[model samples]
Target: MSEPESENGAVHEAQWREVRYEYTPRLADILAHLRATIVVTTYQAGKLLVLGVHDGKLQISFLSFEQPMGVAVGSDRIAIGTRRQIHFLRAAHETAPHVEPHGMYDGCFVPRTSFYTGAIHGHDLAFGRDGLWVVNTLFSCLCTLHEAYSFVPRWRPRFVSQLIDEDRCHLNGLAMQDGRPKFVTVMAEADEAGGWRPNKATTGCVLDVDTNEVVVRGLCMPHSPRLRGDDLWVLNSGYGSIGKVDRAAGRYESVETMPGYTRGLAFAGQFAFVGISKIRETSVFGGVPIAEDRANLRCGIGVVDLVSGQTVAVFQFLSGVEEIFAVDVIPGMLCPLIAGASVDKQERDVWIVPQPGSGE
Candidate 1:
């Protein structure tokens, strides 16, 4: 795409171009007609693992990405965590699925003496008949996680599945198997141990929802794993590849990745929408308050061609520059959920969640 202005004080237009690999914006008039909704937000912001409209409310969860990238999820009754301390809450309306409070951790990771995992950072989560399954990446040494280091509060999470050893990679994404207790994680790299950080696993692994076990191993930083119409799709966050694995053969390939930092992912019908966060060093700033950085740098959404591995459409965030943290496309529901913070950090917004999967 090219931006050309008129020499005289007149009107100028933008346009897009079609190339072999990328779709360049044309220099002419562009259409502007798109909208999205906010799901929810927490005071502590960083890496994310879950976001979607479940039951009758929009649910959002987060976990650190790098060190002891532990996760934090708050249900109406109380919040659960794998941080530095062990904690829990007894609530009256805790039975409610929504209303999960933030900031408070039911438990935290204590190192050395309490080292099963100081903190269990994660990406995807699934709740089935068996129980709640959380897939996460840990420092290779974490395999030695002890009972005392269980920071998941009273829940005593099954703490299932992890990446392979040797290669340090972050298992950033996860998805459930339609009706079974099966789950999948994506390895961003085709072949690597882990990210820059050590003690991480690189190989991809499969998790048994029934048993918290690192079933498979050896994969890159697979960000998001999804089961779409029987086909498994993995957003290899690091490789910028959307791949699929043939369960029978156990083979996968690098499909495609949108241009930029690809974090969370979801599906609405046949369309695959990805949460694209604007690169900080790549931003113009434009005097926009650092608080608004998320919004200001927030580019729109992009649609991926699952088969062709290409981004067909992009929903930009130039309007207000929202730094999209995570996205979940709910086809069964009317509207999808986009969980993130406004640039200014003054307030946290839960724009969507009108009526639990309601596209309101």
Candidate 2:
């Protein structure tokens, strides 16, 4: 709740970067009601933000990372994909009450391990039956991490002739079903370097990972395909809409369109939490419907009522954040704290050890 202040009462530049934001009063209420915490990564700001409710107020904890992109949350672990490494953190519930402001947080994620994946531009991640599944955008394939090598290739679009760092198809979203990678969303089926950039607005499609077949086509730069129950949901990013893929009809059914470009998506009960970002006004973002009104674009998380397809609450950034890469809901955790990788000495001091009389 406190920000660094200077002599004139303005935020200080030398201290930690100031993050200004606003949210509907109900946003905190909704999170508290569900007993959940929202985690979002903003590569543009190199931050992983944890949003929760503390005493009927919005509490935000910012952790530093190097261009953090993909985030995967499980029952007891959280995985974060950065520029050149993937960090794994395990929740140490035993020590949650000791986290300063003692008892304010109900969960504490302590960094436990990391794997160097080079600069593969890894995207969406999910824990599956086989372990961690990553959308390796640079190599145009789905891969898993290993201790001996950077990554082990699992699946790729048949159109991609070889594994290379060209970002050929811009394969960025992965949806896992029944503990396995089921579907993915890509900008295009292009097989050449940067080939998906030109027609990104119209060539985006979703592919079945098992069959390597395009399930739906002609999307508007789609990202974050997810399976909620029996429905296949995806973000039509360029058009700023959240929709579902009608597999039988081979088309996308728009559910709700937000005010900004949408990318990240997560589901909690009957609600969908979506990440919204402003258009960059570059050729990369041109020719998109949402880009037409850049002045009204917003950067925040929109809580959508899936049953009604209407946004019920919003959390907006007034400054210091422009884009969001991933969003995930941490269920049953009202407030949580994440120790950033090497950001402060506190992480070094915190330790996780077995309880007395526990087996070694």
Candidate 3:
């Protein structure tokens, strides 16, 4: 077991694990009384909550609908963009808007009828130096980064570029380097059009954002990538592994594996946090994800030491909730959370999500 240095010598984050319920608000003297925290992400059933750690609490933002696949995070206010609707919300743990019971919760910032006027799919979003980049992954494939305050036609959205006609895989994960784009996908230019299947074990490439061209291929279902020093540390979901890419050598190596389908990787200080979906029902040594397997692999948040390559802490899912999409550890706060999944909406675990001053 991984051990962390604490006030008491070697304490593990596991000492504070519980079901995702509303029983306790903060940490209790005893570990057993803690309730798991699951923030209401706004992706599909609400998207995954994307967190950027700050002072003592996590600043959470998520996406919704189809086009606005990004959320705006502010110091005291936050906004989530849906297809044509955007909800500018006050920060949470329980902050509410000045509306009535329903409207009391920060409501829509933009209406749904205003976005996706034609046929555009927003794949990724990032905070630009003075704007935001909303990527459209298919059809007339394009990457457009816009000014943050340029929310109207007067400023105009800047078009990065389109992929080569032969590069057919969806441009899903994107990052900005020095005010430009760096993107990754499941296939590349030399790839056959329909070869971008999730089940197959394939490694495509990472696009050089400046020229919007394919630079690296042969990635194993890579998801979250962070540009560290001279390497790109990426969470490769296909092998349940975290890897680093030699930017100059163009090689991939498996760092470690948690033995499940993994995605959403984030770094806090010296630790790496990864989100693993339900334990692959029944994965066969790198085959596609199996469908009917009903086994849950204690999914939650896993914390590892980047330097030593050891998993020191884990916060498990509870109260029938089975999966977490992402975890963001804000500074100061002992427990950090971003987005998680309820059993389902029919039996929703609303308590997992938090606002500025909410009790329920």
Which candidate number has the best lDDT? 2
Model 2 worst lDDT window (10 residues): 1-10
RMSD of each: 13.7, 4.1, 10.3
Ranking by TM-score: 2, 3, 1
The reply for model 2, stretches above 4 Å from the true place, is 1-16, 344-349, 354-360
Weakest 10 consecutive residues, lDDT, candidate 1?
26-35
Highest TM-score against the true fold, candidate:
2
Estimate, for each residue in 99-205, the C-alpha lDDT of model 1 and write its tens digit. 23432222221111122333455334444334434444443221212255442321111332233443243444556565343554534232344442331234445
lDDT of 2: 0.88
- Kindly list the per-residue Cα lDDT of model 2 for residues 1-360, writing each as its tens digit: 112122111121115666677777777888999999999999998888888988987787777789999999987899999999999999898798877889798888988999999999999999998889999999999999889999999999999999999999999999999999999999999999999999889999999989989999999899999999889999999988999989999989999988888989999988899999997868998788788889988898999988888888887877778898999999998898778875743233468888888986
Better of 2 and 3 by lDDT: 2
Return the lDDT, model 2, position 64: 77
Better of 1 and 3 by lDDT: 3
Rank order by lDDT, top first? 2, 3, 1
Error of 3 at 37 (Å): 11
Error of model 3, residue 41, in angstroms: 3.9
